[model samples]
Target: MGVDLRRWWFDRQRLRGDLLWGVAGIVLVLAATLGGTLALTALFPGLAPVGEVGADPSPTVAADAASGLAVNLLLGWFFGFAIAAFQEETLFRGFLQNLLQERYGRLVAIVGQAGVFALAHFGYYPVSAWPLLLVVFLVGIVTGWLVDRRGTLLPAGIAHGFVG
Candidate 1:
């Protein structure tokens, strides 16, 4: 399996029906969130924080940021992004998504995948990684939804990077 990541992902895709619902889920989340936010802010004008942009002319932070960006790109692209996406979607969004979909509904499956995604990250460092638990889980649901829509994991992975 170590060398068969593409084949494994393709096989998994063949087994699951096209993932259109997954994409819808991602779109719904974004749309719903934006709509609710706008509605609430219109109703209660002073709720949202307005911040002024402060210019940072320091080259040190800029250099560090650029370097960090470079490193992240190298790792995110070259270090088997498809494999990582495949493994994650297979477990959280494939097997478990189906189970949740059958047991409850499509929403449940998306939520279940998100939950698993968060927990997986939390397991990496239970203490310091607590914050990731919430973040990745939210991301999981979005990715799961993407998988449902895209009919494959590759687009989902690419979208994840695009959003990041």
Candidate 2:
């Protein structure tokens, strides 16, 4: 399975034109998400209060940041690009969402996956951070829609990486 997966992954025909569109889609979606977040934060500042129980950065995260700029960038690239974008998107969007869509239709699959994606972060965020959950859900929807539009997971993965 691993060998087959690698072969398919590196197949030039399968990957043609994905890089350009994927990067472009990611940039567009990221800009929209950031703009929306800023607007929401401005309108409802209470939703994003700083130094609150769930708002403070974790010690482990702070330590990672303190590990110096190069280390931080490397770690970010590894996790954001390799893990979150490629692996997670392949699993969630490529396999799970695609399977669900075949059985249940597009809307159900998108919303269902988004719900799962939002819930998957429950351990990392407190219930008080509902705003973040909402954003994550919205991002999931955007990524899922991108997958459907592009007829491939590359664009979705790119957008997901940017969101991460």
Report the number of the highest-TM-score candidate. Answer: 2
The residue-by-residue lDDT of candidate 1 on 1-164, one tens digit each, is 24343542444544343344434454654554455446655666654222222355455587689988889887875543555655666666666776687799888778877887777776554453244345455667667776665545554554453333
Rate residue 135 of model 2 by lDDT.
Answer: 66
Clashing pairs in 1: 19-148, 19-149, 20-148, 20-149, 22-145, 22-146, 22-148, 22-149, 23-145, 23-149
The residue pairs that clash in candidate 2, if any, are none
Best by lDDT: 2
Q: Scored by CA lDDT, what does every candidate get?
A: 0.58, 0.71
Residue 98, model 1, lDDT? 64
Model 2 C-alpha lDDT per residue in residues 20-123, reported as the tens digit of each score: 76777777678756776787787777774435764465456655566776786778866887888887777777777877998999999898888888778666
TM-score of each: 0.53, 0.74
Q: How many clashes show up per model? A: 10, 0
| Model 2 residue 24 lDDT score | 75
